[model samples]
Target: METEELQAALESAGLSQYQSDAYVAVLELGKASAVEIADACSVPQARIYDVLRDLETDGYIETYEQDSLHARANDPGDVLANIRGQAATLAAAAEEIEERWERPPVDDHMVSIVNRFETVLDRARTLVAEAENEVQIALSPAEFEELRPALAAAHDNDAVVKVSIHAADESDLPDDDALSGTVTQMRHRTLPSPFLALVDRTQACFAPQAHSVNQYGVLVDDYSLTYVFHWFFLTSLWEVWDVIVSERSEDPPILYTNIRQCVRDIEPLLADGATIEVSVRGYETGTGVRQNVSGTITEATYAGVSTASGEHIPLAQLAGQVSLHLADGDEDWTIGGWGAFVEDVEATRITVESIQYE
Candidate 1:
């Protein structure tokens, strides 16, 4: 390196401007009196001795008397070692910054917008691993495979994992055994779709599809914000899809996250005068205080016209007041799903505790 560059580097290495210049001068001269170093560099003659003394004390140079005090450059073994170590640390830090730029670590923010979808997925993995009640996910087939391990972990924890796998063709579909132990329900979306994962009604990770003009990711850990994404997942990514695999129990004590699905499953049984008893977990509509209601479902009401197939309620039918009428002794209550403002209870979870055949 040039002398000026070397002096600048020495200053960056923790040497004062005077010390770096005086050291460089002494190194070039091999040996020099204090006055000679002051004349050879920018350091004033008055401060040259103090500068040389400091440089010597720091092991950058050695000074001794040979007729008069003279300065000489030291071996620089320790100095070079320290500078190399600093360089290596800087290089490693630069690489770490690049890696984070590509795929950032999951942040602590309640809501964060990120540049890469991988970041959203990584956060989803974390949330899924910690899931307690339910997990809803929609992704491409390949992406589903990528998250299978986390889904399996959640499933093992008894978290209801409902997955929507979207692909352009049937060739990308997962086999029946693929979701056997990893998912409670798996559906197929016959087209490319955006990525979404909602965990426990409190966290959500969302990313637009590749075909969109812009690509970005949103991570949410707030209940109010996640609720919005939860509905988006249900209406757009989930409800319309065709079920490919389902592990729903045929007996009582079934857990339902979606009230519409609970109604669809038990509607016929109720029509046949089968007494369906359930435990509903949700908040009171007007007060927003959490409460539980357990009793027999006496009736169900919806707005849209019923489909001729009668297999499931149409999504349009559920848009209006789709509520379950529960009778607990003489007292009765109306339970609504998700966002329930007009009903007595906004149900978040419903467990069918027992069923009685009349």
Candidate 2:
């Protein structure tokens, strides 16, 4: 390297500019009077003596009574090692900057454990904003408001957004008008609960309840693991809660938060020979390939329901298994919910886009 560049590198290794310059000069001269170092580098004659003394004290050079007090570069083993270590550190930092500049690829492990709840929440914001089919979240009222903008953006993109606000009382509930256009359905639970956000049925961000003994978070990018979190969201955080805001339509083109709700509403319609033309957004069960399918609902099947007696069935009753037979053009597909192990497709959002009387 050039002398100026080498001197700058030495300065970066914790040397003052004058000390670096004087040391480089002594190393070049082998043994030089203080006047020689000051002449070779930018160190002024007035400061050359003090600079050489400081360099010798730090072992970068040794001063001796040679003719008129000369400084010779020391063995330089330690100084070279220190400079090399600093260069390595700088190189590693540059690589890190480049790596972090781009979006990181999802790791092969699918699940990442982290220390802070905010990490999961921040990732949830990005996932929610990009959600294609569905977004499920359970958080405190304040967190709901914090994520509201991203939720609203997802909702605007026609994604199904269901949120459960936990640890909230009547006073913590957001005004209904404030919730409009931001969520498909919102429920409020007065008890504390863990934070969770599941997006598109494939990714989940989860954290333990704040009062838990050990606080941490789990971020999942795998379909199966995310399905587990999805059910936790349904059973533990959402199903039992009372609706605070529901943007569902009671008329045609009805929107269902999930496949179970859609099946419950459409079972009677199919029984009455009403052809349900629906559009569904979800992924294939076996391949995890996502698609939007528009077809006729030929049949609806689920356990724990009595269509013969017209008895009212709660959604939890049919949670064990629910599937719909969809006839699209010349093909037929069986659609299931959240985690469909046996069916062809796992429907995340089902809409009664249009219906016809057969």
User: Which candidate should be chosen as best, given lDDT against the real structure?
Assistant: 1
Q: Candidate 2: TM-score?
A: 0.69
Give RMSD to native, each candidate: 4.5, 8.5
Tens digits of lDDT, candidate 1, 244-336: 788888787898988888888887677667888999999998998998999989888888666535467667677777899999997999999
Worst 10 residues of 2 by lDDT: 100-109
Residue 108 accuracy (lDDT) in model 2: 46
The estimated TM-scores of all candidates read: 0.77, 0.69
Q: Name the lDDT of candidate 2.
A: 0.83
Each prediction's total of clashing residue pairs, residues at least 3 apart in sequence or on different chains, is: 0, 0
- Tens digit per residue, CA lDDT, model 2, 1-358: 9988988888888999999888888888999888988999899999999999999889898899977889898897998888888889999999888555433446744787777777778888999999877898998878888898999999998998898988655887778766988998888888999889998877888888889999988888997888778778888888888987887888778877578878777777776778889888777877878877889988888877555544445766786888889999989989888767798888767879887785
